[model samples]
Target: MIKEQGEGKSRYMPGLDGLRAISVLAVIAYHMNVSWAPGGLLGVAVFFTLSGYLITDQLVAQWQTAKRIDFAGFWMRRIRRLMPAMFVMLAVVGAWLLLFDPERLASLQGDFVSVSLYFNNWWLIFHQVSYFESFGPPSPLGHLWSIAIEEQFYLIWPILLTVLLRFTKQRGKLMMFILLGAAASTVAMAMIYVPGSDPSRVYYGTDTRAFALLIGAALAVAWPSRSLSAAISDKSRLVFDILGGAGLLAIVWLIWKTNEYDSLLYNGGLALFSVLTAVVTAVLAHPASRVAKAMGCRPLRWIGVRSYSLYLWHFPVIILMNPSGIADDVHAGRALVQIALSLLLAALSWTCIEEPIRRGFRSPFREKIQGWSPFQYRNKRAVSALALMLFLISGYSSLNADRPADPSPAIIDTSSNGQEGTTLPVTDPGIPAVVIPEAPIPMEPQPKSEESSKPATNAGITAIGDSVLLDAAPHLEKLLPGIMIDGKVGRQMYQALDVVDQLKAEGKLGDRIVIELGTNGAFSSKQLRELLSSLQDARKIVLINTRVPRKWQDTVNSTLEEVANEYANTEIMDWYSASKNKQTYFADDGVHLKREGAESYAFLLSKTLQGG
Candidate 1:
């Protein structure tokens, strides 16, 4: 162990900041395009590790030197370090929501309150939030979800450590056991449950994420003495440097090759690889190691130093500047411009907002005030205000609820009652049957006993499609009265299928399955075939041929026609014909249906079902 002569000052580790820079950049790039960088989100795993190591190290050192941990002082320092910048960022994000999108303003308000109160992760988990979902990219503070996780860990880990130290006087072995147990449990859980579970739950659960942080904490607690560190010769250091580089490169490569479907496996692998790299890097932390010096480069270290601000700023910029309706447009030039803007904004926030507040909290005046009794310092007042804000936000969200429409709709067929044979609706109108088949014999009406089950008045409609299908739900429900209509919206058809299966299991699958997918999945014949296969159970499946705003009409129409031909149950709703060569149904957010268009679509859909 390196001895410190001073009371407050601590030795700075080399290359840690550079590693942070790499992680943050990977996250930004991954969010920008998961296709380009599959495992980019692993940056958060790296961050958790770094945070665990540093925070544990600080707390353990303080306990060792002082012989007693000053819990109040320790908590105060944490609040001062984390809260001010976080609150300021939340305030900014809140202001942005108010000015930009009023429809999503309620959710933003709720998220802001949760983030400020250090419960964003819990809120997100309960709500089943996914950062990549099409609820229009989340606020800039979406990144704060990880921060919430870390803070929550800090709350528990310290108390556990303090207790362990008080009793055992040996921290290293205890930490190792805890870390090993956590890692084993996490891996086991992921293997057994995550593969077959809801992606949202798997992505956001705290237990699923704890292993990454525990690994770092364990390393910090079990750090070897300087004598052991010195025993690592130049050859060993060189070998470690090579291994670390390979590990880092492998992580980046894996990210580019993976997708959201593979998140559990990718994250598990990355965490293990990262822990190994961290261990190797720690062993080679000497001044003579070129890898350490490279990782401590001036520019990279500078970016790493302000990584928190960059992480906070990047998502909001990408979300807010997104084109009206396109979810994933690969406009390299536009993205580059956005990236530049994000960097500028991050720099300004880091210098003008975060640094000033952080420095202020560390100043002599603030220290003197902090030394006062807890009540005199007014920390309770701040806590009370935060509580009130959270209450207000929750109340607001509850009051402004956008209740989902009934999932079932009454099926109307006036032409057929108890008939024998009926001509089923088919794509080829010329081959109309001469006889109309009778509806299935009505079950004998049992005496209306009190225990008798009521007839289903509304069988729910499942609208499976891209983002546009989501936007059409309200209009659809309005047009098809007494029937429940809900949308399973996603960027990929496979995601839509997943939701469809869930709805079926929940008994929300209606008599009619309406499909308006194809915008994104149209390019892939395999996806279209898969979607058709998934909808095989539906009594009636309606396919809306793609309509274009302008340039992509030909491409979208071609894809739609191909899909229509491949399925027997499919009937193409002529959206292309209805639009009359102009974009009618879509909103400025090109992928979502406009109100007028959705109403038109609902009318057409109702007519098609009624005619059948």
Candidate 2:
């Protein structure tokens, strides 16, 4: 996907670029928060396999012709194709952040250095940055993790292949070696994956992801593109087309049906998908496959040709220019505009930068300008290079300049009656906020009956929740005296049942229950249902939805909305609606409450619980 195969039609496989088009499109769709493609993240895995196949094929071709891999030339070719667009992107994103949002710029230097060095994936992993757990504005360069993986493979695989070929020239044995490596990688991923934790460790690790690349490399070793002949029986061609088409359909299904967080994806599911992509790659490489002909149509080829540039530019455009505040989930019109901007930038980069550098910067106008010599050009470029570098350095330094911290968090008295408050600071550390003003309103769908069985006061009310509830506890107590509140830091939905059961046994289970969990991460609908069932004896239940700015923000709120609709006495208290876009009510980290937010939260819950 990074660069097209230069081999003529019998071997070049534009259908593979067709595959590139599909893969890149899937990734872009995922970034755009399109409803149809939850598994669009799998698109990166597809590109990994495609890259392994193409790069290995190119290397094998060189080996067949020259009897050795040209390590220097191969690496240079890679740099020329990949480096130009990326460096330009870095300079532009850096400058943009410097001028507009400098708070983020302080931390971006690491990302810049990691990307420049092609170790961004490792940087994220080692730094304990969770890819799925992002809360604030995401690093626009975050998607470069895949590029780092591919570049690492490009750097090492050729040398490794040389050693392997030197070890045993037999293709069968070579494939076996590569396949064994792939198996080890798959097993490592499965073994390392913890069911409920952030899967970023395995997701970003080079060793765990090597299986996809190795699968493609094995395919290339077993079926070199150069050796495939145009002469084939019609029956064989039909078989190729049918199998290839089926593989493509299956890939599409997985992209649509699956999600990144599903447990099965880590266990063995991704390996299976990688194998399917390789099969599709294999069929597309065959000379007589009609599937390849159809896939290589003009529109698909055009997109495929610019796929790498598109991939490079899409994420940045979305992060920088998104209209809606939910970060990834944009409205359709805004999504389309952002996508079009991405394409425009990609096309420009491909035409002006990527192609020119890869083709040795040979200008079409070189012939027109008489006496314009390479020597003169080099001298002028050298003189200008210092000034350009210094200008860039000065801008980069300004972006890194220290800024003032906000005034210390507001002093809200979290004390009420004889009960001591949880007195912790309400400011959640390092959680950036991208608040969406249009987040869902509370679902108080007409209750089956007009029964007004609301609690008169906090007499029989019990509030059980996470740190957010803790933040607002003092206000809740002040607003509704004698309301029993139980809250702890980082409490998730699963921990609520035990607390509730303990309270019941202690003769403290209130007839009115207010549950506010799932702020830490997403919980299953089953968990929510079980919690509701346990509180069935309560006269009224108020479900507080979350305002977590992380990826799970929508999931937590939606599941609460969905599950609350099923219960008769349950009603949602839309804290997210009250809090979104009111940044002054929040600490530096957007998710937590300042005094105003806590007071508002307490008042809202009081109103919702008392049937105001």
Against the true structure, what is every candidate's RMSD? 13.5, 9.0
lDDT of 1 by residue, 358-435 (tens): 565354322332111122234544643553343334323432342223211111111211113343221112233223
TM-score of 2: 0.75
Ten-residue segment with the worst summed lDDT in candidate 2? 410-419
For all predicted structures, in order, the TM-scores are 0.62, 0.75
Deviation of model 2 at 156, angstroms: 1.5
Among these predictions, the greatest lDDT belongs to 2
How far is 429's C-alpha from truth in model 1 (Å)? 41
Shift of residue 188 alpha carbon in model 1, Å: 7.2
| Superposition error at 25 for model 1 (Å) | 1.1
